[model samples]
Target: MSVSFPVSVRRLSAVAVAAASCVGAMALPASAAGPRHDAHRDQVAIGGVHSRSDRSLNGEWVEIRNNGRGDVNLSGWTLSDSQGHTYTFRRFWLDDRSTVRVHTGFGRDSSRDLYQNLRRAVWDERDTATLRDNRGRFIDATSWGYGRNDRSDDNRSHRNDRDDHHRDGGRRH
Candidate 1:
């Protein structure tokens, strides 16, 4: 049966169908979305930090750990500080349950440590370290020395009970 409908009615029906499709997709759990989502959510984390260093620039470091069962390619991943100083990983593969320490000063790259080759220290007493994937998606963050009343634009979204330290606190290569 062929039935003619008003233009507005046809458009409404099309919109409704599109909305329903979007809702259905959204209802699906993140796991159903695929491994990519899982990788972004739980595979990697900022394991530790050595913010203060009196000996040398290399003394300051941030450790990134791969917590998943499979090797994670961190080739294009980035680690940044609250001051916007950033370090980009270069064709590196982090093995499962392994940790890589990114140092602030110059040093030869190795399986365990990578150097930023900077003259001055990067981490501060009260600062946040943010890690992002190759596509600039937030992966994990570690913050230290901040109080509840302190506020900062850089690490606001990353605030959590575990890393609640706050203070007003970036992409420097």
Candidate 2:
């Protein structure tokens, strides 16, 4: 059977929020990291909005990086657009000090065939990514701009350099 609508937790009426310790997660702060943060430290950067695909495929995806020193469960979390639109999650399992890339449409209707066909309008370049806790609170959210290659808030991502988005802020994270 196939689902006709999005399978995001946004459809859920209400989900109880437990302690962060219960899930072994803390609030992620990109603001503290500032415009230029350290690449070595562990973090989970929530990316931005992708444009609708005319190809009628969905490669519109989100990026979640593990920028922390420990492993964290992405379960019971949600993502919100700068426009205030929200996408929720259920099982966001990640490894410690490792990064995981998820198709924002995962359970809703994510297929490799669909991803391969869809032109990725990634949330990477110009948008601010706000990651929330189980209660929908912010973990870490940032707008990757300035001191980096893109520098402008225009949603334009760097072509071939991960360092393009990574900055030292002339300080440490």
Candidate 1 lDDT by residue in tens digits, 6-67: 99999999999999999888877654757665565588888778866888888788888888
Model 2 lDDT-worst window of ten? 109-118
Model 1: how far is 171 from its true place, Å?
A: 12
Q: Runs in model 1 with CA error above 4 Å? A: 1-33, 148-173
**C-alpha TM-scores of all predictions:** 0.66, 0.43
Query: All candidates' lDDT scores?
Result: 0.77, 0.45
Worst 10 residues of 1 by lDDT: 164-173
